[model samples]
Target: MKEKILNEAERLFWKYGVRTITMDDIARRLAISKKTIYQYFTDKEDIVYQVVNYHIEHEMIECTRLIDQSMNPLEEMLMISDLMRRNADMVNPSLLMDVQRYYPKAWDAFLQHKEGRIITDIKANLQRGVDQGLYRTDIDLETMARLRVELIQLGFDDRAFPNNKDVMTTQDQLLHLFLRGILSEQGFTVYNTLKNKEYNLTAYENK
Candidate 1:
């Protein structure tokens, strides 16, 4: 029952920003009584914190799996970017802003994920890419890895690039730019080959 509530709340919260999604909304969406929800959660903030923690834990597992199974660094990045692009559609534009503004505890969970596990993951990916010659060796690994981490937030910046949910998404463009900036000449060739075959960038308007 707890898992069910968290799952439904996650879906609702993703579709509707956290600030607007009330306990009643979650209970109504799940067709359960408010009493049932209260049994599992002390308040809306408690639910939000648990939900955010659940999401981060699940994402970390998937990210590790993706990185481990990738054919190369470029393929790993492309896979991650594709996943993000798909997820961006389900995410409400105000979600991050709402979390930061209203839910301090949940926001701290997000920050922990961003600054800790996420940074470690990207740094490992960059090091692996550099060793494999899929990324430029001369680049400062730490600085570039941190930059990539920070750039991840840009996808949620609605004011900068509003969610179009179209063929050419802002997230997609940002991914292309970030990948191209880090690739070696050899890496670029590999990127082009796979990108043409897999993504078919020509299908998008920005191409």
Candidate 2:
């Protein structure tokens, strides 16, 4: 019952931002009473905190799997991008903002994940690319990794991109720019080939 509540709450929170979702909404969706929910969770804040922790754990696992299965660092990034694109619609733009503003514990959990695991994985990816002669050796791994982490969250900043449509496009453009800056000639050749193939496939499907 606790897991069921968490799952439903996660779905609702992802579709509609956290602030708008009340315990009644969750209970109604689950066809359970509010008192039943209260038996498992103390409050909405506790639910949100648990949900955020659950999400981060699953996300890290998926990311690790992607990294392991990818052919190279660039492919790893593209895989991660595809994952984010697929999930973009399910995630409300205001979700992060709501958490940041209203749920301090949840927000801090997210921040810790971002600064710790996410940054570590990004740094590892950069190092792998450099060692493979795909990325420029002169780049500072720490700085670039931190920058990428920031870029991941930048799309949700309403002040910067108000009512932004097409987050995938924004992410793709940012990735292209980031890759161009770090990729070597050999890396660019591989990147361009993959991009051209993607473009051709997109056109073909559109036709």
Every model: Cα RMSD to truth: 5.1, 4.7
Q: Residue 139 deviation, candidate 1, in Å?
A: 1.4
User: Which regions of candidate 1 deviate over 4 angstroms?
Assistant: 162-168, 197-207
Q: Each candidate: what lDDT?
A: 0.78, 0.81
lDDT of 2 by residue, 1-207 (tens): 998898889889988889889999999999999999999889989999999998777677767777787788988877777666666657777888889989999999999988878899889999999999999999999999998877767767776777568666776677778888889888887787665333111111111
Tens-digit per-residue lDDT, 1-207, candidate 1: 998898889888888878788999998988999999999999999999999998787766666667777788788888777665656567777787788889999999999888787777788888988898889998888898888866666666665666545423666677788889999888988998877445321111111
TM-score of 1: 0.88
Candidate number achieving the greatest TM-score relative to the actual structure = 2
The stretch of ten residues in a row with the least summed lDDT in candidate 2 is 198-207
